[model samples]
Target: MMQNFILCLQEAALTFTLKKYLYPTDPSECFINPPCGCLNPGQEFQCEDCPYLEACLSSFKLK
Candidate 1:
């Protein structure tokens, strides 16, 4: 029983770590090429009705 519990805990920890690595908790940690200058706080882009939406989305990359 204890061994199973330990395995479960390890699995949970690994899952959490993998998730953290796959998706950064902070938006500023994104790896975008050419950088989007129009990105507002909360990592939100003011792309609504913006002329650069296509270009911005094209170059956006997540680390």
Candidate 2:
């Protein structure tokens, strides 16, 4: 029973970590929400002029 409990805990932790990695936190990284919203790859937005462009690009590269 204890072994099964440990396995469950490990699986939960792994799932949580994977979810965090996939979605990420504060994807916007902006103080005021822009009209276009947070930048994501393949979206039509002024990424060239965005202050968070670098961060967004890095995140997208991970995908």
Candidate 3:
């Protein structure tokens, strides 16, 4: 059961990463939403060009 849980987590992580749905200034700014379609991971190699998500990382959330 633990292994299954881990696998689910891995899959969710992959989906999230692949879609690059990291929070933007808002959901409208999300890449998968509108006006940002071309940057979908595996579809385009442009992750390096994106600026860091504003205050969305773990270090910021804990505060």
lDDT of 3 by residue, 1-63 (tens): 999999999999898887644445443344443332345633566643444422233334565
Q: List, residue by residue over 1-63, the lDDT tens digit for candidate 2.
A: 999999999999999889866553565543234434544534645644565556554676677
Q: Per-residue lDDT for 1-63 in model 1, tens only?
A: 999999999999999889756643544444333234545533555534444444334444432
Pull out the clashing pairs in model 1. none
Clashing pairs in 3: none
Per model, how many backbone clashes are there?
A: 0, 0, 0
TM for every model, in the order presented, reads 0.35, 0.35, 0.32
Better of 2 and 3 by TM-score: 2
Relative to the true structure, candidate 1 reaches a TM of 0.35
State model 3's lDDT.
Answer: 0.51
Question: Residue 9 CA error for candidate 1 (Å)?
Answer: 0.2
**How far out, in Å, is residue 10 in model 1?**
0.1
